[model samples]
Target: MKQVPLHRLFMVLLVLLASASCREQSRVPSQAEITAISLKRGQLITCGSSDKKFGTVQFDVSCSPEAQTDFNLALSLLHSFEYDEAEKVFAGIIDENPACAMAYWGVAMANFHPLWTPPSEPELKKGVQALRIAQSIKNKSPREADYVAAIAAFYTDWEQADHYTRCGRFEKAMEALHTTYPADKEATIFYALALNAAAKPTDKQFSKQKMAGQLLAALYPNEPNHPGIIHYTIHTYDYPELAALALPAARKYAAVAPGSAHALHMPSHIFTRLGLWEEDIKSNLASVASAQCYAQEAGLKGHWDEELHGMDYLMYAYLQRGDNDRASAQLAYLQGIKKVEPQNFKVAYAFASIPARYVLENKDWQAAAQLKSRPNFPWKEFPWQQAIIHFTRLLGAVHLGNTAAATAEMQALQANHDDLLRQKDTYKASQVAVQLRASEAWIKLQAGHPQEALVLMTQAADMEDSTEKHPVTPAEVLPARELLGDMLLQLKKPQQALEAYEANLKRHPNRFNGLYGAARAAELAADGTKAAYYYQQLLRVAGAAKSVRAEINAAQNFILAHRSPQS
Candidate 1:
């Protein structure tokens, strides 16, 4: 492949990217209309693959023009989860206006992406420095002090507490700030987002997220072009049950500011949740292309981690459509990501998941069983990534009737789980535990221990039921209960399998494997009416993707032979 001349085409592509997506009506912010909803912070200078002004944010900050512009840029980056870029902007503000207390607040806020991951020890210290800078400046307004202090509360005793605890402190502080300035839109928006960041996956009532949604939803009409409101709102409803509510935001977010690679990719979170494969494919293609230019401009060689992240979403969308060839190509494209330093969470996830899904989605148990993590991958340095590969191997081995290998894989998974636990990484440790137990159950089932397998998998499912799936792949490598449903079907217990599948479908909703399995189970159980209903739904999403599944063809035949009123 010829190396693209990134620096030469940078400016030309920037203009094209911004125009290609976002519907920008807003402009550079002014303080006259402090509460004006039409403020456009994203008025950025785009270079091919890079944006001189990445975030199209509108700030309602009570600071000087220079400070406010910098603050707006910083907050816009934060909204897109571009913490490093946001913090840099914040640092520039501090240099430009040492007395700008809010710039410190911006710096602190930029250190953490509330919904994704916690700040590192170095990040926390950087946040602390920003706070100290704010404190030493005596000419700050009372409101500016509160803003800085709110973030300060988040970093207090950072090493002594856990990530969630710090997140809670930030939320508490934001609550106080919002209360103090009830009408301040920025305070209200930030507070709502902080609540969302601190939300737990099992909050079935989605209480905290619902609160964020209500705040964001109410503000949406007023701030139609506001990236934070639109982006955060999409996140607010990014779940299987609530995805429909987020469609408006998802449809609008990328178009509002396509310069940010993450902004280009954010909409797919909603699309993935709702099984909107076509939209996901469309959005990710543009996002990956946009990200590549920026990566190349920054001198990155093979895989741009950002581009790979978009590819992961794109691959899942293709897999849903049974486009095995596209998936094959996407995996081949991913192999080019050889350089290491920038291995982010998304990179780590795609590294394992792309291959794992390639085989697992086909129910190709033999391929999964023999899956290997390449010797070049630094397994110890990235045990979490290693854990994903092992989980797939365990699932494949047990499913393919290789009990000994499955048992070993399960043990390896447990060791990784323990390693995470030792590091106090509760969130990932929980996920590892779920995979570990699920693999063990599959191993037991392969060894003819049906009762034990069911119990073990049930327990794992119950645990996962209370939390959200990791936001890497579209969903879990098949939810454990869904796998149990598959196993039950293999045992010829269609009734039990149907029941298990229904329970899973309720939580996961329109997942391809779940929907297809439910249809097959229903047909086997002699319930042609329900079978037809599910088969039709599956066909709707499957579209025209090739590489046929025999069961899908069987479902199509059954549906055609006895079409129900609903079908």
Candidate 2:
């Protein structure tokens, strides 16, 4: 060949390198490529690029080729949220492959998402039947077990899912990836995600995040920039202790793939939790900004479904910072989006808090009361919220001089008390309801209806004793008992008030409010000796408040001067 100019040679080399880069980018594979990549990475192999070709490959791998093709098509339809089409596809799969396990799994998965689909008993039974058939065909298939177990789990059948996951029968569901051929990076990433989803949130020692992190770290050690691993490490791991390790990893991943939804959502969730744990609003707001930017990008790319997934963290962060306007604005935006009903509970609860903030800010009980009656009031769905709504409504009614409404709300709240207490898993709801009843009684006392308050308080105390058989944390019962003591004092039942306060003090040794209430009740009972003792105890426990200390000292002086002459 003739000697080429150096510049021309350089241009030729540049073109070659550019062509190689383009080839790599254009190598996006079909579904069949997913399987092929799993078996052979870094190997150049050409397969059919069209969906029809992939369908043929899928048919080859499946035990029942027609059934497998139908099942895969159904799943693809389901992923597109075409429920009617997916159902038809699944039905065809079941018809062709009557023992097709995944056909049932597809139906179940479809029912679980979108939140609008009411999964009937028949559907559940069908799913279970399909799972049984699948199990018979291949007892080693973990995915079949997982699908069956998930249906059980969704119906609050935790015991069933626990059984399968513990027995390792659902290991395929927990696999890092699934492939018709061989697993690839995408498969691994998705597998880790599935595993994380299947992991229990309540496991004290082994959290979902930790399990996810371990899986990701093992699978993608070479790709430190992998979004799946980094997101898991940051969002799932307990913060502060692991934040140093996870934050750097997350930042690196984001730098590499700034547009990755996983990267965006994970950091947002992590920072929001960190803020709540540390009570650091500034850091949380910064994270929210990143989340919003990434979430918008995801939305623009027809990924609105994923965008809706993590907006709750952003909504809550705003709520925590007392930015009700921002919270309300964000909530409105979320509501405007399609398929937001799945997350309605969270968004509704945030809105419910708005009236609470209004109450605190304006002290406008009338406005708060009116807000409670509005449609879509979340308290109607959740017991704790209902209790809070009723309690605040009572306050608002009292402020508005509407005793009848207040009394009616109180009765309604009390009616739900027994049902609330029966809920074992929802302890917070029970506690809040109890506290609200106590508050209602206190309001009666404040209104100068001492006898009414006394009756309500006595009933609350008795209910607390009956409902909670085992000893709970003292903090849990303090609010109920504290209000009861106050009601007793208002009723001029000083002896009973003193007893309640003393009992609470015994449980919570250093509680300043209990000691103070005890001293006040003793004084009301004209027992200078006991009153002085409680005042002295109150002085010791009241760490802050020099003014309170001075007042206690003055009371002690008065008690000493008025000591019973017999003593």
Candidate 3:
């Protein structure tokens, strides 16, 4: 050792350094080590220290330098909606170190921010290029592979968005934001928006509008100043019930952002839905005033101006209050100003829908059908519109005694049944489908096709399960079961109907329909004790349901009259 020259020693040291680099490149860490390191630092790394007692240690480090840190910071900012700040930080890191693949990955994450005004084609192309570079430097990390899988699933062109989001490439903490966590409000909101943006256009495609509403409900559970959410909700009035569902959140948002036109508009819409006519009008007026003030303060006016916000609200308020004349006047005013731009199919459709709604409310089915059939019906933009149009046509056909036409409409509905099930846009669609099937089954029963009717009802029940992934609500499933029970009773299958109704009642004890159905089946079967017991249960559960209360009274009187005294 002492005899070795200085240059020779330096050469030996260089050989050792090169060898170490090569070894590190080939090293692969065990799963336990990876998990331990990830838990400790909340970051994904390429290698983990080996356990001494382990027979073999396979460690391969694949992570690009500084990738973990960049991904974590980008994820934090993305979640917080700090897009500009995150972009700036990621951009700076990429500039400093091009091979720092995580920095390029952050660029993809930053590009997904909803609030960021979308880049031009050239800009997006550049961003895609950066992501490809990051993807090329990838290692054998499972987290990285997961990220790549997600990117492949989502952005087909970039493919890295999925990878970054999935692989713990972005903040490891944000892994909780996946679609698997249905109840996580923040994740739900993000996923809904992502899907809404990504969904394809087709004849019976997924409902972007519905997904948007679900996200809005999750994000602003009791508040509503979210402009994007409010806009989508108002535009898709295909589900009026959603307005009621969103009211509490909308009111809360309005309370916080008193100056927000959307905040005021949301409550106005909700009040109208709740049939609080006076409050609806007042809220709309306030929204209109605020819009005008905002316009003046912003020094904006006329059709192209960003501040011409309240015309839609004004129109809706007038129509809701039965002041059609005023609504027409406001519509004319909106036409004249051209100050506010109609962003989507919602604006023009609103005008057409108003007339259709009037006819429906007046029970003028033929008139409603005519309006719905018009070219400007906005069927493509709103699924509910299509559903309503068909529903109206069905009603008209039924009224006119056109059996063939009514049957044809029913057939068409069944064909598009999957679309109806997938809808979360409005609870009404789901309820309507159930009722429609039940009605169709009743018609079949009347025609001496009781078995066919039962089959149809069963199909309807299955559809309910297909759409809603969560635990089936007793309220929803019970009605369908009770309807089936009635059909079975009509078919002279009282024992089967009794069993069905009893099962339904077990799940929904307080349901008047379930109790009544069971009672009817028992009575028809000549089971006096069982009939009496079911009738008594019906009365006890009727509570405040007006129809059920009346039925229960009638049944109790009949039972008393029919009772016989025995020695």
Highest lDDT: which candidate? Answer: 1
Note the clash tally of each candidate.
9, 4, 19
Query: Candidate 1: lDDT over CA atoms?
Result: 0.76
Model 1 per-residue lDDT tens digits across residues 459-523 = 88888887887666677866888988987898899989999999998877667788888998998
* Pairs clashing within candidate 2: 38-182, 38-183, 39-182, 176-191
Candidate 2 lDDT over residue span 461-527, tens digit each: 7555434311111123234566578667756789899999876654444344566678889988988
Q: In candidate 3, what are the lDDT values of residues 1-567, reduced to their tens digit?
A: 569999999999999998887665444433342223111111211011112010111112244455445544444344333344456556555444544545555555555543222333444554555555555544335444444444323334433343223222222223334544554443444454555333322213346546656666555534334433443344333223344555554455344434345445555545544444455556666756655654454344533221233454444444433354565566555445443332333333343344444454334657644544445334544444354455555545655556676677666555444454564333335655764776586557655676787888777655543442111110231246666776687678999999878865543343445666788888888887888887776554433222323456766875786677861
Q: After superposition, how far is residue 152 of candidate 1 from its true place, in Å?
A: 0.8
Give the lDDT ranking, best first.
1, 2, 3
Predicted model with the maximum TM-score: 1
Question: All models: lDDT?
Answer: 0.76, 0.49, 0.48
Better of 1 and 3 by lDDT: 1
Instruction: Assess the local accuracy of residue 34 in candidate 2 as a C-alpha lDDT between 0 and 100.
Output: 23
Q: Which is better, 1 or 2, measured by lDDT?
A: 1
- Model 2: how far is 434 from its true place, Å? 7.2
